[model samples]
Target: MAAQGQAAAGSASESGGSPAASAAAAAAAAFPATSLYVGDLHESVQDAQLFDVFSQVGGVVSVRVCRDINSRKSLGYAYVNYNNTSDAARALELLNFTPINGKPIRIMYSNRDPSSRKSGAGNIFIKNLDKSIDNKALYDTFCAFGNILSCKIATDPSGESRGYGFVQFEMDESAQSAIDKLNGMLINDKKVYVGPFVRKQDRENVSNNIKFSNVYVKNLSDTVTDDELKEMFGKYGTITSAVVMRDSDGNSRCFGFVNFENADAAAQAVQELNGKIFNDKELYVGRAQKKSEREMELKEKFEKNIQEVAEKFQNTNLYLKNLDDNIDDEKLREIFAEYGNITSCKVMRDSYGVSRGSGFVSFKSAEDANRALTEMNGKMVGSKPLYVALAQRKDDRKAKLQVNIFLHGSWIYTTCAFMLFHNSECLVFACMVGEKSGEFY
Candidate 1:
């Protein structure tokens, strides 16, 4: 019963089953007949019920109502393979709209479309996910268009489910086809929105700019990846690298930056992707600058503030204080020079040129000087701690805390006794009063 030898090369594409009504419409148009996969059959319907209703005007070879692989419950869809093209044509024409068991019967040819036919137009997106839908499901759903290297469904901690996911196919044609056909299709009653996956900026950055050599893109769909981005942008330029950033927790951020090997290529990518719609979102694109540049730029703003303060304190003349006896102004300036411009550093010395244990560090800007003061104050250099408090007048501090007391005759007692004890480095102070020689002495 094998048609192997009799079957020509094109015969496989041409089903041996006859058209139930007519193949003129399909064959004339050169359109291959695809099976009208039926679903939601009433539970008690049988093969006879289906055949009687469908085979009235068409060639009939076999009607196969597939059931669960193990449990064998009616899967609701039946495969009707007709013997002659005419018979198959008749069945579809006659019964596609016929009602059986309160559900209209649809009769189309059966086919298992391989990866070659993803070019048709449709769209796909998935939802109502139980969080268990895995990468294989994602790939299998879209891979029919072409080769798919990998796929993934986002999951939660404790490995639960994130209710979302991404799929990557080797061919853009396949991805496009999936987007077109499945975008609004109802699978499990959930209307899925399918489109190209956009990756996070960070992952894309790592792939192209940080870890790889290419343009980075942000505001990507969480599902976008290295390969897909390459394919999407590959037309624009020779992409040296591509990546979609993933959170440490393993989820894609919404956007990513793309770095092209040359500015020209990156410009091309931005031009092509900007305002372009993928997965229903307009893509954001640009060159990714290194993260450290922002820090340096912001820190420079404070430099002026430091110099302003320093000018008021020293009038541009270095007044060094608290200089370590062993270290001099030359050493002090050298240490602070890395912060910014240093006009001068001169340690104060007494008449004998002895170190005053205090020194001045003069930065060109009050900003830098104050930064040093704030950051370096109280910082210990070797065994000694450096004090960076405002340079106050020496005499002002000495005059602030003076106290005065006047003793009068009424303030004195006749006699007084006091006792103190010391034990193992512990000091104790105590007082007692007693009449010593005269009244209350």
Candidate 2:
């Protein structure tokens, strides 16, 4: 936003600067075909006020005040177009810091070539590096990237590396090159991350070692030995070293590692073996990421997917079918009062939220959910048969999921069985996977 300014031509009180002529001139230029960009106006400020303020500096092209599309609220920033560079320059000089209704306006030269701006800061965050990796190592790793000006490694009180660091390549282009080649690259079994230098430790763990490079093999024929493993892989490259991890029994740990003389061979080996059938066991191979990284990724994905599914049916609402037609929320409450606290329940209706045909009952705990699903899953109540799995209203089923279904029933079997056993003592012996003991009818 830096600019060079020239002095204004004459005083405003000059006879030629009569208020009538100036306002008319400003109004006339307000609708020029092109070249206006006005910015930094108050939300309540109208387009006319902006035109009046900017037109005084130079001829206006078009004035547009931005507003939210849905809410119709002012976005606080607006654009004004001028017919040419001269007027824009004059406006920038004249209005850059002038306050309008107590709010300062920031005027700048509109970028004619906006594409020149960077899309994103390239990846350069250090990741998966050993906590032992010091600032020196971080500098060493990225210096070759380019003429690094300033590199920073975040450390703790002891000065031990916090497993991540940052390197500024002294220039933006060099930083970009490092991003292109090194992002998602493995460093000590981790990937180097790159981005604008922000102080967030959480971003460092993002897929640091996701580029697969190791293999998981099980059901290894007892005959397969470490040496045999090496011999098999030796054809690929000058072997780095192959070690068969062994159990306490000292048997071939059933898995081994083969470092290649070159990365290409290792890459090919990984590609060929990932999910390829070998020696009867499906050979799994890919970039070998660390265990904690894999766990974190899986955990996140599990939680996300579970939440999506749970949202399909509102996990919050519970439905109770087969209720006694005469039974209402109060009557049902008395029957199940001993279970636990109830959030809220009403027999659903068409428009009144009344009971449609069968009503819903909710319990606060999984124990309650289990008790409801189990006690009501197949129980014949009154004249209707009660059925309960989870009751999601039709409208709710189509909405975004708010509840987490995966975490909802950690021990579904036990919760369910509790309900069945509580119903009767006949020991009719009905078996379900989650229940330890069968229910007796």
Candidate 3:
């Protein structure tokens, strides 16, 4: 798929087309393919199992079941490639939602380019869905409007519907028709809300403009009373109610809430009073939010901070595996000290204080780490070759592994499967040797 896009772009550039035209050609080429993404497979499903099912429709080129790099567990999805597009289409029509290992699989044309999907051209969001509406029922309901690229009922971990879902058609007209005809219509005795799907960031931006009549205030002086608070904020707005929060003994808790008669007045009070010194303390004032909203905002802020920290240390830390047993913190540092100044180095140990054969090294700069990684990776250290790479946070590493497994599907599946088989054989051989040497006895 990627090769086709690259070839299309290359031909367009060779023909003296504008850069925009070249990019357009590349994107156009990416969509026409004979590969299909099969999702929601049972964990036990493998490439051979998928090939058996898909090959019934046509000549199968390749099948791959993506798995986690570390756990070697199925990711509940697979990719099947056919020799021709017609057979692929036939498979999609006939085998979609077919039960495999007692679980129904969803099939769709594999789209490598994300721009078309992210454009939200033909997507609609439906809410207030009946609990019993599953993926198949949703698909059957909307398929009449037009060719649906994808339809799903948002489900919780236990597989119960979450009262909402998304349906994406191949044409915007179909999505509009569904929204017009079905918005506020009764489905399963529930009034459903159908509307054009808005991305989360866009939704958040829209919510930020909503007006509020209640304002939150903090950093109050201990002696401040409700009457004092009302008097201070009454200059900007008509105070409907004001209270300084207190403990059971009636001692001020250093925070309070003020309600204005109108949203405009509340907004003006917040704008003027925020960051203003009152009772010798700076006050923080803003539109009051529910607990969930405050939590969501805090979570987003925390994630942003984490991303900034990750970016600040990118490529400056290295993870090392297969370390020699003799390698301690000082020894590890000495090994990479020639490349750069070491910030920290540690060989991981178990509770028994034995080296776990892995460690980490952090350099003062990314350049030094890169130099050490390039020179030391796979180099023989003791009895085994070292495995070295840039250290990644747990979540980042998992995401990268998933992307690698998806993008390099077939090759990763084959290589990892073979490695697993080879390791099993080596373990058996070691057991045999140990038995003969009476080591087990």
Candidate 4:
């Protein structure tokens, strides 16, 4: 029922049930439908200006531009009330998207109950407006395109222009026409941006929030300029903007971002230029990632690599300690090969190139490794008892250094500390006498 254009006003009494539906809906509304939402208002617009503009189509009972309580500055939008619903609807059609004081204004039926409102479904968002443009000027510019329901420019608490605003059109065709004709048109020497309006939450979830067609490129030449970057990527399609990151001194950071007017152009640039050698370095071109997302990706990659390495050596590697310094890789393999075929063996060495009295041995299967561990653990070697266990990664070995042994049913307690050596092979046990026993490691 709200989706009406200039024709909708006179045709409200069409034979279909639309008129009845609209009447019934309006009657059920908490507030009278004789109120209109007027947005894209310039910060300088006063209640008098709103009344003057809206009274052209109807007898305006009141006009109010919302303002901050403390600062008393215009909030960039206002509401207009008329004694009759027909007058309100007429005002919405004639004044919407029309320029007032060189700025385009938006008009729509006011629905104070946000839950019942369609939000920005029939609205258009415009940005990059000139600060000096006023509501009247904006309204005059776009009034010809459609029956605008409301127009407004956002403002800061202090009433300064936020350089953006919204316009609500009654009909989808009118809104689309405005978008097609006025998007990218220069206003006050600044190129304006125009698009369909959406809620802030919806805007955030969109994949191309930054731009519909954008690409991130890095490893660029230090000598590259914004113009150069744009020119380079412009081959695929019309370029909108290209910026090379720079330092305060104006030196290029060798990275840049490029935005095209078409998504296919951006995809083509990513495909053709990624890993392409430029300025003696391979370019890293792809979709841009926010700082937080990039950090998370790196962390996940590191963890995945660690897990892969851990799985690669699972069950096949055995840790051996208490070996004599004379043990070489060949002799170590020879001894472990008794149970099954030994794939590899190596005794860790010190700076002097001598064995550190420990080594790791890999068997063909987990069964052979387990058999060797079971049979050789705590068994006598040449001069000392050997300790055999599953070979652990560096992090795992450090974790096992702190062990807590339970001594149940024992009244006496001793503080035992096991000192681990640099190679993680030697363990020296020391104890201090204590009088009472509790849970201790």
Candidate 3, poorest ten consecutive residues by summed lDDT: 431-440
lDDT of 2 by residue, 1-441 (tens): 110110111122144643323322332344222344444455567888998988887778778788879856667677788766557645654565467865556543343543322232332566666665655445445544444333456654223456777664434676776665566666555555655654344446553323333444444565677887778667766776776667678876455566666767777777666676657766545544454444445445544554444333234345666566577778776765665666666665557655566665556654455445655577666676767755532433332323221222212221111111111111122223231011111
* lDDT of each candidate versus the true structure: 0.50, 0.52, 0.71, 0.68
Best by lDDT: 3
TM-score per candidate, in order?
Answer: 0.26, 0.35, 0.52, 0.34
List model 1 lDDT by residue over 1-441, tens digit each: 111122221221234432322232443134344333444455456888877765676555666788879856576678776656555554555555456775544343454564432322222334555444554345334434433323445653112345666554444665676566666555444555666654355446655543323444655678887788778887766666667766679897665544556666666676677778887777766555443432233233333333233224432223334557888767777766775677666566789988777666556654455556656777777567777643332333211221122223312221212111111011222222221111121
Winner on TM-score (2 vs 4): 2
Ranking by TM-score: 3, 2, 4, 1
lDDT tens per residue, model 3, 1-441: 111112322331353643333322332344456888898887778888899999999999999999989857788888999998777777877787789987889877787779878888899999998888877767656655655667788874334577999988777887897777678777777788989999887888888778999888888899999999999889887888999888789998788889999899998998899999987999888888765455445445444544344356666778899998999988988888998788888888999999999988888876677768878999999788999987753433321211111112111110011011110011111101111000111
Q: For model 1, state the Cα shift of residue 297 in Å.
A: 30
Model 2 scores worst on lDDT over the 10 consecutive residues at: 1-10
Whole-structure CA lDDT of model 3:
0.71
Q: Model 2 Cα RMSD, Å?
A: 19.5
After best superposition, candidate 3 residue 57: deviation in angstroms? 1.0
Each model's Cα RMSD: 37.0, 19.5, 19.5, 30.8
Taking all chains together, the TM-score of candidate 4 against the true structure is 0.34
lDDT of 1 at 111: 40
After superposition, candidate 2 runs with Cα above 4 Å error = 1-46, 66-78, 93-108, 112-114, 118-232, 250-256, 279-282, 289-441
